[model samples]
Target: MTSQGHVNNVIYNRLAESGRVNWTRNLAQFSDPKYQQEWFDLMSPKSIGLILASIRTDFKFPMTFPDRVTVLHKLVTKPDYSSDRFYLEAVMYSEQQRRPAAKCFEDIVVYDYRAAKKAPLKPFMVDELQATYDLQEQRKEEAEKKVAELQTFVQQVEDSAGAA
Candidate 1:
C-alpha cells in the first residue's frame, strides 16, 4: 500500500509470481505420480525449470489491503502444444471487490539447469499441462456461476464491515 492508500504496483508482480508457482504445484494434484515428480524436479537441482521469457499485466480495478485475491492460471494453448515455450494466462480476482483486479500473461520456457539452456517440453510435462488445463476449462463454467453469487456475498460483507 502506498501513502495514498493505493496498492503499490510492485505487489501485483509478486502476486503473479506467487500465483504461477502455486499453479505449477497444483499440476501434481491433477496427474499421476510421474507428473508430480516432474514438477518437483522443475524446482530442484540439475533438472528442468520454468524460465519466464516475458510477462504482461493489465490492471482492471484497484484493490486494497485486507482483501482476498484468487489468481487463476491456465495454459494459453490447447492440449496439443508442441513448442519449446508456451504461454499462461491468469486472472487475478479481488474477492473484496468482487471482480477481476488484473489479468496477466506469461511466456515461459523449459530451461535445463545443467545445460543452462532452453529445452524442449517433455511428454510428461505436456500431459500435465493439458490435464490441468482441461480440468480448469470444465471448472470455469461452474466458477462463473459462483462468481456471480460471490459478488452479492462479498458486497454484503464489505457493507457490514463499514457499518461497524
Candidate 2:
C-alpha cells in the first residue's frame, strides 16, 4: 500500500488508471452517499473507458459480493428528487437485463448502525451451568465416600484396641 493506503500495482501496466486508485482505497468510504457522489465525479468517462480497457486486460470479474457492492456504490450518485425516479427506473430496467450485482448488492452492503449493534448471546450458558453442577455433585459423592472410609477405620481401631 502507498502512503494513501492505495494498493500499488505498478507491474500490471494499467497506464496508471484512476479507477485502480479509487478501488485500492477502502470501499467503506462509499458508505456515505456524498462520498459516493464525489468518487463518481472523479470517475470521468475517459477514466471509466480506461478502466473497462484495463479490466479487459486484467481479467477482473464476475466479481465477488463485496466487489459488486463496491462497484454499485461507485455507480450510484445520490439522485436529486427529479432524477431519482428515472435513476430507479434505469436500475430496475438494468436488473431485468441481468445486471450481475443486483442480488448480492443487498447481501454485501450493511448499514453502520446495524453492524454496530451488540451481538446476541447464544443459549449455551444453561448447558455450561448444568455441567458445573454435575461436577460439584461428583465431588460431593467423593467427599462422602472419603468420610465413610475414615469412619470405618476409626471404628476398626477402637474395636481392635478394646479387644487388646
Report the number of the highest-TM-score candidate: 1
Q: Model 1 lDDT vs. the true structure? A: 0.82
Query: Per the 3 Å backbone cut-off, how many clashing residue pairs does candidate 2 have?
Result: 0
**Candidate of highest lDDT:** 1
Instruction: After the best TM-score superposition of candidate 2, give how far the Cα of residue 155 lies from its true spot, in angstroms.
Output: 0.4
Could you give candidate 1's per-residue lDDT for residues 1-164 as a string of tens digits?
A: 97766887778878988898888887766668757878867655558888888889999978888788899888887545466788899899998899999998999878888888888888877877777668778888899989999998999999999999
Worst 10 residues of 1 by lDDT: 77-86
Give the alpha carbon lDDT tens digit for every residue of 1-164 in model 2: 34553333332222223333444243325334444443443244322111221122232222221121222212222222222110100111122224432211111111123344322211232232234345556776999999999999999999999999
Error of 2 at 50 (Å): 60
lDDT of 1 at 145: 88
> What TM-score goes with each of the models?
0.76, 0.27
